[model samples]
Target: MLIVAIILSLIFGSLGFIVTINNAKYLLSGYNTMSEADRAKMDIAGYLRFFKRFHIFLSVTLLAGVLLLYLFNHNWASSYMVLYPLLAYAYLLAKGNTFYRGTSGQKSGTYIGIAILLVVIIAVGSGMFTSLKNSEIVVTESQLEIRGAYGIKIPKADLTNVSVVKQLPAISIKTNGFAAGDYAKGSFRTTEGRKVKLFVNKEAPPFLLLNTREDEIYYSSDEVSSNDLYKKIKKWQKE
Candidate 1:
């Protein structure tokens, strides 16, 4: 069950991020409304619709994948994590003032898109909370360690280690694949005790994937000096 959960989480998370990047690229490549084309010549709706299509479809697929992930694991609650991805995607599509009041098209596409994005976000966020409401938690002391691409190249010794409650606030799913969340480039101790989480925030979208990078990271769930561990990763990256 644990392995399945991990795999499904990773797969769904990866899919969500992938669709987001592609959508971003496809949307930004062609149009910038600021350029004033002749009013009669311009097809505002048509131009904007191209970008909107990619995001709309991507959001739908991402949400569907998230749902399947939860159903497969019977974790109907963790499903709310889907909102993170949804918000990221929605904001991307709706953030700009794509709608104008003078036009009859004012509330047609853009309004509905924004509305859908918002509604789904609220629905899923509610689910994430209820899912974890009734679960058992175990805590115990452990050790700290760091790892890398090739293998466990670092020991727990170079950096500062802070131990907080094992509870990590649900990170936005859109930021899940990118370094948009708390652990974008850092490490987190996944265990319930003595775990330390590192925060990294230097990633670009469409390329550097957070969850994928996460798999190659190290966790320090126990109390330990991180001197040796940090050095190992530094040296390894250099090599």
Candidate 2:
């Protein structure tokens, strides 16, 4: 449900951005191929007026979707909500490239290159702002359940070890995942060649570490009592 809300929010938010004068060209066929002088002489007053109202409507709808996500405690999806606009912008650029090629007789290769560059920027930006918010760990006798960006369910039968630590060991590389600022939410490889999945906010401490036969995972939660969590998991491990 939250995923759907996020998709809707992104769709609406991106449309609002594309309708703006400065950014509209990305979606306007032939706009990219137009020389600055030609662009300057173009009349977009009608489009401006129409998009202005449309932007408002979409913005309002996006806010409502975000509100619902928040009210329902679907916070993991909401944590990265700000990225929706950029995702939308990327969509527009790709779409615009298609339209521009069809109408402007521009070669596809050139526009494809530009589109790739724009996509790289959005992907990097999204990674930098990646954070671990509204995440939780549920420890049971049979398995450990994670609810967040790197969510999963780990059976006790696969667990080789479990511990709570104040800080993570040095990570050599992120094998596949997201990292931004002090938050590292994704899969990473350690200097010791351990494959670890992390969902962390650097500001928070006392992380839970789980070692299955095949992988290691580190996760934390600000909303839950870390000491109590440690005790519960410890009990489960002994069982």
Per-residue accuracy of model 2 over 173-226 as CA lDDT, tens digit each: 988776643467778988888778988765578887878887778876677756
Give the lowest summed-lDDT range of ten residues in model 1. 201-210
User: What Cα-based lDDT does every candidate model obtain?
Assistant: 0.38, 0.64
Candidate 1 lDDT at 216 equals: 32
Please provide, for model 1 over 1-239, each residue's C-alpha lDDT reduced to its tens digit, 9 standing for 90 to 100: 23433464556445534433325334442233323332234344553554455445554555555556655643342343445556766665554434332343543555687788798788656644433222111112222232321112223232222222223433333222222112232333344432222332112111111122224332332223234334543444344
TM-score of each: 0.27, 0.49
By lDDT, the best candidate is 2
Best by TM-score: 2
After TM-score superposition, what is the CA distance of residue 71 in candidate 1 from its true location, in Å?
25
Residue 128 of model 1, lDDT score: 47
